[model samples]
Target: MKSNLLSLEMMNGQERLHEALEMRGFLVKKEGPFLMLASGSSKRDLRSLKMLLNKLHIPIFWNGDRFQLLTNKFPVMMMKKITEHRGEEFPVSMEGYHFRWRAFVNRKNGLKVDALDLDPHIACFVKAVNEAGIPCLAGCDGHLKHAPNLQFSGVYSGAWFQIIQEQYLSEFELNYTWNVEFKGGSGSRLVASKARNERWDRHKIYEDTLKMAYKLKEHADEIKKRKASSFKRNAGMKEEAEGLRTDGRFEELVDWMERLSN
Candidate 1:
């Protein structure tokens, strides 16, 4: 593994430090109040960078987004000295295509867990599914060499099945085609189909997948709204029945009770 320690030592400011780290294959970005670092695709680089940070006495912690430098751990003067330099802030938009972070709650202990950064292409889809109340178990962007896919849990419900079927059949002929495979009790997988040996159109797939994600979210929201409306109507009827009973209107109470049963 290559080390950026020597070059970092020679760096006078944050700009220089950022450049040195980048040259050593680390992705450096500003996230909120902290500087964040990622190793991109290299485990060796990540290990080397972690070692260098430890040697420098910089406290870092993984915060779902990236390894964030704990600037507060240092004295104010020392922190200012080390972090004083400015350059263009890292782009916050998807144009940069950095991996996305997600936080999951551990069911066993109910503790918040940080998930590994997701591939940029499929991250939004995963987020959409999750926000729509379906659990996304895994996803792959296919690295442009195969079909990108997402694995989901609890997709056997009638509503989800219908939505998946509609999307799968409707998007079949598109450049970024979609397929849904049901695994019975195991849940379902949504695949962005690509022919063997055909490189995926990453940008196209990203755009198409996002559209599909929006559609799924819309359907999920509609279902939730319908359920809520049904529940509210039922509760209102029950309240009306109780009011009728309390008012000694036996005929009205019976009619309300019969309506509720039906």
Candidate 2:
């Protein structure tokens, strides 16, 4: 194993992470949620692959139009000095991405159970980027091969507004932590323990979240319509039961219910 590159054994949720490597014909091993990939000559290839995943560009339907964001659906950008990345006011620039606002939460560290500040700063950052007519992209730290880091960030950012629909208007909770239990692995904890005391304006974060929701209201309504239609189709399965209850044959109805249960 190259000391410069990350070890796959240290990665959390490798079973799911295996899919990405498998797609490229890399042999992998799974022990619970952790994974191990063959190293040596393939190591450089692995790192390069992850780099590509970190900057994936994909399209999403937003407000009746298609929008492209960086690196697949979720952009996973990691910060070296996350707290400093935010400005005294609005729009903190971390690396090259400008965050209009940031939020922090106190949560138990997935690695050692120590409390840490879980910052989903990217959540509101992406929202602001999209609102400003900029192509939003999720970013990664370019280190570990964890699933939530590699995969869920992409998936979460893709449906961020929908996942936190009602709560979008509420106080920004820094409580978002990706937790998946493993037999011997720490839950792919992303936060460092030193930054638990970072301060943020909850109200301002809430306002940015609301802005994100308002911008995507049309898309949310469309999603609701599709869900309702799906429920209506599934409700058809109860049509026979409703008919039986309406008819006067009580014993026959009981028999039909028994048959359906079986």
Using all chains and alpha carbons, the TM-scores for the candidates as numbered come to 0.39, 0.18
TM-score of 2: 0.18
Error of 1 at 80 (Å): 28
Error of 1 at 37 (Å): 21
Candidate 1 residues lying further than 4 Å off, grouped into runs, are 1-116, 154-173, 184-186, 217-220, 226-262
Write model 2 residue lDDT over 4-123, tens digit each, in one string: 134434433322234333322233344443444432113343453344334442222222211122222221122122211321122212231111111000110101100011123233
For every model shown, the clashing-pair count is: 0, 14
Cα lDDT of all candidates, in order? Answer: 0.45, 0.28
